[model samples]
Target chain A: MVEKDVIVNSDAGIHARPAMMIVREAMKYPCEVMLIKDSVEADAKSIMSVLGLAIISGSKLTIRAHGEGETELVDFLINLIEKDFRV
Target chain B: MRKLTVRYFIEGEGRIDLQLRLYAGEGGLDKEIKYGEINRPGLALAGFFDYFAYDRIQIFGQGETAFMNQLSYEQKMKTYSDFFSYDLLCCIFTHDYVPDKLFLEFAEKKNVPIFLSKRGTTRFITLFVHVIDEIFAEQVTLHATLVDVFGVGVLLTGKSGVGKSETALELIERGHRLVADDMVIVKKIDESLLMGAGSEILKHHIEIRGIGIVNVREIFGIRSVRNRKRIEMVILLEEWDSAKEYDRLGLDDKKYSILDIEVPYITVPVRPGRNIPVIIETAALNQRLKKIGINSARELDEKIKKWIMTEGQK
Candidate 1:
């Protein structure tokens, strides 16, 4: 398993558009991805689970992935967040 | 777990049940209630602060109220000052007994909230303890679906797309009830029972992959939804593994621990042809039968052992 913590720097936080982008990016990988905030883990591949986190600006979240391509998946997700979901 | 504030306790359902009306100390509404026990300041009023449980919520019943009425004006003033010296959480006046103006003044000066209850001393304490216990209970939120199957609360858990919500939807169509979907808040009550409920924002809403967010209550009606249920069993739906062994005899008991309470756990492997909902319904019924002292697997083993022994004797 691989995990990386990133702070949400977007001005608007993770609303429907950003959450959908995260979920879409996560579903491309075969490994299991999860987003954890404050001890509650949400599936990164599920939009509902990601939105349920209610993550706002300046929120610290851990991007975690397990199984095949775990490290790359985590790095890819952290890069996405760092870029403010630009891609 | 979050801190329990004085304002939250008063705003909860216990407010109406206990007839709690705030008398003073509006500034202290944000004060934290650190303990669940209730304390009566009968001894504190007598000018003895030794071993005083000052942090607990103080209750002034008929005995303490009558005692204060008999004290001299100077003594009453002294007693009020002495009582409010400690960093008390709050105080309650029971049986419709209102505190004197001096007492409220002291409480307000100390920024300690004071509440009045119409219930008798004993009744108020019993109900207050019950409500406070729930507030301080250990809680955790899980990414799972909780459904009521045949009067048994079964928590469905697995990976994201492992059919947890789909199975719950089928169970609801088969005359069961849905408690929560996607996120279930499970609280350990009284150290023995685990109560599962839906989150305030996602209550009774199921998000099917293709169907988007659907209101279960609107589609399934009122009988198909419940606000909360005691979690009795946990079912984990996983993709069928070709090499892994599954429990076929139901002999070895599997347990899933949530908040330190162990509940019966079963792993159901999902496949194309298997009927997951019916299996869950049967599991719930089997749990109820076990609760009533009937162990089908053990009973069958015992019967078979007796028959083999008689045949060997013959």
Candidate 2:
């Protein structure tokens, strides 16, 4: 498994639209994806789960991926979160 | 879903047999009832059809029938013709009142179905509206598991094989009620409220990865399952990743918009040794506390800020 911690840079945090974007990306890879916030964790591949974390502009999040394309999945999520999931 | 026809309201599956008998305009039984609301067309009957909502089913109570009886035959014909000029879905006369000749003639001429109910206006309205609401409410299917935790509706959502059903099973074992599993039909009952229910075939049935399908109501008894619930919050379970920085303070009052209404939301990572069911339970209770204006994190932040002020003064 591969993991990386990134800070959310979006002003609105991971709201519905951004959460859906992340889930869309997460589903592209065939790896198991998860996100952690403090003691809580969520499925990165589920829009509802991603929004559940309520990751705000300054909030930090850990993205983890397992199975085949774990490294690529982790890198993509980190970049996505850092870029505020633009569009 | 689209609006239901008048005939379907009486003969459809889950139909409410309110003993509604047709008095006139039987040919208009196929007319569609768009809104679930009933209207008393007193104004329209009094020759004021300016704001007449033709889409609604008119209710002619005793007051309306008596008023019609007081009018002369020619006057009543004019009133009925003018009223029926607008395309109404139907007209229902309460208290089993028979339609007058002019009313029946106008109903037949205008192709507006007329129904008679034995129940009073208030009782029949209540029952008819209740049935109509069920048929006409806006609905959308969601891939999620819904459970009731401490009377708060908690919807568990995640990708395939993300342990959503497993977490729901644990919650069910802990004395919570399971509203739906796998496929939840979320209905927008009002502007700010959403209600969720399972498909009839999948009601109370949860599918675990290896265990196949398990019936929650059968295993956990009737108290463990409910037909539907008002969704209050959503908890998403995901695999654990060491590199992501999860929300530690929870100061962000996050919301998930479903059917335009925002609901409280949380994400719990799924990993070995993490008790997700307990976290969901606590999350539900915390939501309740927030509803009552008890925010622990905000209160603590204020307390810390006050402490710092006193320390600096010293």
Candidate 3:
């Protein structure tokens, strides 16, 4: 599994807009996307799972994936966050 | 401390076809050279003969003299066995001729995947190696978007056309950096730290309303486009809804999770002329303030309640 952790820089956390965007992106790939924080794991595409996180700014989160060119996809997301959610 | 050994990481699914036990001895490819960068013909041929003496050798390559040579064949079937290797995997064959029957027989004996690609180059193969490195490295990525607002990493995400680019562009104009554009890549270096960057195709390119695509590096120079950053915040853009109850006070927290990490987020509704860029900027700045343990929204709410109580007493 390829994984990267990023702090939730936005004040809103993974709410409607961000959640939808992430879910939309996650659905495009033929792999498993998991959002993990602390010891809890959630599916990247689910609205309820995202909302359940209650992530605040500075809260660290991990995105893990497997299968079908997952390395590239995982890298793409990691860069996005490393750039501080700029993309 | 013998750290040098062949290590195989099995992924997907597969089984060893034949019960093949490899051996190294005097007669075969073993007597050639010590296991290392066997680029020298002496070393390679040494390895070749040593292995070949045991069974047939399947040397894969492009046609580079240093690797595989078939042009030497028409005259005589050189002292070698079969040769094969994909263009994308390995190349540089010495000749263009096919291997002899002995070599073919060995390949048939050992069912190896013989693939050939006419396209791609050495650089492409290098990329394949890089990816394999990442896999072996076991690096993980988080689903996220990173934009710079006042030098702060603010990951913007939302449905298509929710104004992420517009806000990022606006923030850029306000003297903030643009980390990644549409997508972001996050890699975990350790248990606590995270690194991020932009995709090769979309790096430094942000699309605006009238402008189709503008290169941030070309226009704003390199400083505006960062290679990576530790994601500090996530700002989500959403369409303004009259029925929806938005976060009036910034006390309520939201988070976008990735790669087993929890990233904080802020939801900003888009409607009319509310300055989203400014709000995002303030959000980032506010996050910075919160880092120091100063909650502006909470403090303001507290002041308002105090004032209301005092006014009632008056």
In angstroms, give how far residue A79 of model 2 lies from its true place. Answer: 37
Q: What ranges in model 1 sit over 4 Å off?
A: B12-18
lDDT of 3 at A44: 68
> Which candidate's lDDT is highest?
1
Query: How many angstroms is the interface RMSD of candidate 2?
Result: 10.5
lDDT for each residue of candidate 3 in A8-36, tens digit (9 for 90 to 100):
77765666567656766776887777778
lDDT per residue as tens, model 2, B203-286: 787766566557788899999999999999988777888897777888888888887889988878889888889999999999
**Order of all candidates by TM-score, from best down to worst?**
1, 2, 3
Candidate 3 on B1-314: residue-level lDDT in tens? 01221111111122211212222111221122112221312333433533322221222344333343433543222433323221111111122334445434433444322222332334434443443333322243333356766666788777645677777777777778887766565665445545567655556776554665578889988767787777778777889988999998888777776566677777889997999987887898899898889998889989989999998679
Clash pairs detected, candidate 1: none
Better of 1 and 3 by DockQ: 1
Q: Give Cα distance to truth, residue B56, candidate 1, Å.
A: 1.9
Stretches of model 3 off by over 4 angstroms after superposition: A1-87, B1-145, B303-314
TM-score of chain B of each: 0.94, 0.89, 0.53
* Model 1 lDDT tens row, B64-155: 99999999989998998888889888889998788888988888899999888889999999898777777778888888899999999999
Locate the minimum summed-lDDT window of 10 residues in model 1 chain B. Answer: B9-18
Angstrom error of the Cα, residue B53, model 2: value is: 2.8
User: What local lDDT score does residue B46 receive in model 3, on the 0 to 100 scale?
Assistant: 32
Model 3 root mean square deviation, Cα atoms: 18.1
Model 2: CA > 4 A from native: A1-87, B16-24, B105-111, B118-134, B311-313
Better of 2 and 3 by lDDT: 2
